[model samples]
Target: MHGGEPSVHFINSVLVTVVVALFVLWRYRLAILGGMRRGDSAFLPLPAERAPGRAVLADGDIAAREQAMRQRVAAAWLLTTAICSLPMAVAYMVAGKMSASPTYALALTCSYMIAALPMIAVSLAWPPWRMVIAFVVMMLSFAALCLLAGIIERSLLGRPLSWKILGLVPLFFDIAWNQLWMAGLFWLLSWPTRLRGVVPITFAAVLVFAAAPFAGSRLTAVLAATEVGTPWVYTLGLNGVFMLIALPVGWLAWLRLGKLAADYEAKRFSDAQLLARTWWLMLVVTIGFDILAGRERPTFALLLVVGEIVLFPLVNHWVMRWLGVAKLAAAKPAPTLLLLRVFGYTARTERLFDRVASRWRLLGPVTTIAAPDVTARTIDPGDYLRWLTGRIDDLFVTSRASLDAKLARLDLAPDPDGRFRINEFCCRDSTWQATVIELMLRADVVIMDVRGISAARLGCEFELQQLAKRLPPQRLVLVVDETTEREHLKAVFGPTLEQVRVIEIHRRRDADRAFEALVDAAGGAGSPPDAWSAGKKDGANQAAP
Candidate 1:
């Protein structure tokens, strides 16, 4: 034989057989583990607890229903594993019988199929102790089959059985080598991070390719010494090809197993439905691989591999859609209300500002004082009466402005005298600053307007500093004129001004633009009003033209 070649056909057949066998092992291991955790019995039915005409579920009844649901999921995974493995088992049997030489490759396929039987039985609703016993029995059965096949092959070849037994030593090493790497890959993938899964799979591929030559040397030596007929170089080459193919298949199997366990734990669907879907999908892959493995034509086999890659994801998507087990959608957040605290000098100035602020209804509801008294503590009785009348007039103006802004009807808090209560308090009062801070904390958004101002009062500056320190920068909106230099604003407001959102209003035309910017900075308002309010005010001046 050229280059000491045994047979390319035999090598291809062995590669295909081992690939299917590994899939079976991976799938059933997961199935058995999932079944064990679901408990041993079906959920008992709950006693009737509803009234004659109404249906009300008790706590215990709910628990019973949940238990029943889990049992069904466990049963489905187990059954699916069994049904899926059936085709692979049959394929192994047929391939072994058809082989002309009854080589150790055929024996390996038969032995693996035999080993999988106990695992399938354990997956089917067995208790923990029984499952452990079944696993032990499986290991013993595998060893016996391997020994028997080796002895039979040696006898037919007129060679000593000891030589065949020595070859079987490498099978143990193969199992350990594959298991060690897979365990490491699983551990890395299960790390708690966004790209944990992606990183491990990539790492596994790199590791496999890098370590292939060394691992292939050991595998080839063992097989060649055991009279498997293939030369060391050809055996090494075939092993490299097999590992390359197996890596992806093994990774996918691991992922599916993980998903199955998660779904079973979550009770996302009934077990029967999950089982049916898994079984059918597994059957398709098994049959496809079986045909590809037996193909004498390299071109057809390559085409089949390409088709499997292209079609699998589409099939999986369809199955997930049909099962109603697609990824969960993100929840929509609730709308927020923005509280506006407008600061200015006279009742006229506040009224003009209120008209501009009312347009902010598009963002959210705007709350502020109908009339702000800057010197309430120093005013005489006569002056108080004049201030009260001006406040009443401003309230009417604000109501009309709210209507124009298309805001819902204004619902101002009124005093016993039927006047809208002013949020402003005497700056001299020691506790007034604390009250202001409390209000700021309760508001989702706080706006401090210093338009047309040359300098801020000590009290206003204190309030701004407290707001900056307590509230997040994004939640505070600072409205000023273009004349307010960024450097001066930062100096007057302290370090907090640097973080607060600043919206500059230089002219009447800039009012709308400033308001829009404020809304954007404040993250926008919740629900908009259906219609604007319609109240009439006397002696109200129109906003600056």
Candidate 2:
């Protein structure tokens, strides 16, 4: 081998290794950082805390800052890789890798770099549709490069140029198939996080497999033309062996990576399982399409179709059943006590309450029913009646007299299980006050989130007042952010604040402990009496404040 060939081989191999390593590192950088923060053995352990003599930063703040820095560094590294690919390709060509005039490899590499730049730039936030457009641009760019390379090669060979350019079809298929392979591998490794939508993966697989037969034929033709000593069987066998080795290795690596991610983020494993199901379905469909549409043996294809028709449903059902089993095995037992969550209806407040609730699962299933906004206009009588009847027209009342008769017929029965089943009221419905009052009067425990309350909340404050009057103070657990002023709490509850149990969340970190304490306190309280029927009658007559 010549010096140039060795240099070409070295550069190409280094480029491939570097790209793969960097891509994997970028994809899992967050998980790796989390592992480091958690002192997992897989990641480099953090340095010991500074000596008492030295000023020390909070470990959480340090970890957060480091995570942010790592994310920026990863993004920069990926951007650098895309930018450097072009120069590396040029160097490869200069090393005589592109000695076959018109340099298809060089063209392909340049086109890929061009396509990769925008993708890496937006990979973190771009939706699936945008990714599809980006891939289309890449394919078009690659085809253009191939056509240009083909023209140049023909000119160099002193061959008469004609519309024989159509002969580049094989090269197009080859390029497309390779792109699909790159995309598929990236998606497989990235799994649920990097690719949010299933459509792109499905389309890419379909296109690649559709082009595979033609690409395979083209490869065989090229091999024969080159008269390489290797037999076709040996070449095919080598590819089979490579796949057989690579698939298991790749799968194990993916699982390991996914495990790290799931350790860092609870939802990652569930998302991965969902994406796996989607990919499996895609694979089955792709294989069926190939057999039915591409195979030459019609009878065999028909038989295969018939068999698939019978087996696919069974296989699908089995997979679903297995998923359900896995989920049950993984889940913790459901809590016995059901706690109702009442909070200011804002995104920030809801998220904070949800986070707190999730941490205090021992408390029970937290049901958040948005308290009615009495500041809004009253609901139409027709809508109110519909809501009152549970959206059913079982009692047809044509006139006001008949409607009154139906109202008299209405039964305000309490839940027999004493389960306090509170319907999720629509935000637009102003009659939610009556529903909230009914549920609060019957709830075992009421978790009041008074974090951002400055003045009294119309519906919530009134409900709290009623709850304090009817239910014991122990059953009403008030959650206030430390930042909330004492004056604000007094304004909401008046002098009755002395009786209720208050849990103050001093910081985000303290929320879990505060919530857990609230749960314990709430659990000790006796269940409220069945006040729904009495409360409903009173609530029907009273106007919402």
Candidate 3:
């Protein structure tokens, strides 16, 4: 528009938009998806293959809700991607006309601009009463930014940008560009929302480009400064120095807040309570980082602030994930994944940001529902047992209590106070310690929850022979999930394996026949007598499947 070459400008803008959109889409892809709870780094990821995992069911209980929940999360991720990119179209046009010889700079400038906006606007996604304070702050930021930009650019560049302050810095510093973008992004990335774009990764790719022009420039100054061009190096270094201090501190604040929220929620704090408190903690960290460092070493402090603001979440997320996996020593593996994880980890972390903001609270509504609200009331305890065995399956619900109750009903389960007890545990949470394996050891009759469980080490059949040997001569109850059970049953069981009794549990509380059979066979004690199965008649076939 400035040059009046509308066609050329249009073409360039199109490219810019495409590039910026791609970066935003990829950079925040994981966050968008994770917001729906697909890959809960602290818990576990349900398989995304879309094929049902193992299911142990009786005759009628439905237990495929886990699958559906995962899918919904994936869809949410896709939606987030859409929301983030829709706002970046403006930046792309500006980038297209800025310059093209330094493509990387052009891209970086566009990306920074694009990345910058949504972070500021995020405060608006919520209402003003609860979120109002944050939004007002953002608005003030926009105002102050306008004043500063006018002084800086008009005097410095001899021209002025419209709403330049709003364009660069988020007015609402707490949920401003850096904080909101990073927090919201991390919240979604850690789950299984399905955002299939290249934006998140594109940002990383841009790093390579940024570093290209300055390669081999970080040499020891004393040894070479007198000979060649080291000033450029110094310039780059100086710019970097400005970002080191405050940036890191800001980022750390975010990480700490998120991790704290997750820790509290897992301990069973009401979600509403958690949301309300988290906002205060987030604000404290924001203001504290600024007050403590923003005033002392203003420039370096700002650098640290910016650095922390941008990088801390990534570092913290990686650390948290490593901790969750039970690694004795934390390892920094993939920076890209860590960055993405930080962007999405917030959904599980906490919601203080939404709570304290007076105007924004409406959009970030948190309902305090108890466990009963999320329960599958229609399904009974017996049906839960069947569902756990992969007998009946639905992809829409999860009943933690039902599953827990099934395991608790078994006499063979470890003592609740004992070290081996895994009641209320899932293989998703651990690869080796599910209760199904323990039940195989001593109980003559087991009401196994096969819903969402697998048959391999990560499933119900983790340790096969041991399961049979633990209750040798007593029947090894096979509770199979309906979807995959048919295929598995034909393979794991045979006629001669009389000690193996495969009971198809239907609905919850429909376990009467299974209990009665076990009782009659044990003459009341629930133990299998000698020659319970086809005995040694099929010893070789005992190794079947």
Separate clash counts for every candidate? 2, 0, 124
Please, what are the lDDT tens digits per residue for candidate 2 over residues 38-111?
Answer: 32112212223222111122231322332342243234323433343344334334433346445455454544
Local distance difference test, candidate 3: 0.30
Listed in order, each prediction's TM-score against the native is: 0.25, 0.32, 0.22
| Model 1 lDDT tens row, 399-466 | 22322232233222221111121222221122234434544554556666655444543335666666
lDDT (CA) for every model shown? 0.38, 0.40, 0.30
Pairs in steric clash, model 2:
none
Model 1 worst lDDT window (10 residues):
530-539
In terms of TM-score, the best-performing candidate is 2
Return the TM-score for candidate 3, rounded to 2 decimals: 0.22
- Please identify model 2 stretches exceeding 4 Å from their true place: 1-345, 358-364, 370-423, 427-430, 456-459, 494-499, 525-545
User: Could you tell me which 10 consecutive residues in candidate 2 have the lowest summed lDDT?
Assistant: 414-423
Higher-scoring candidate on lDDT, 2 or 3: 2
Clash count (model 2, backbone only): 0
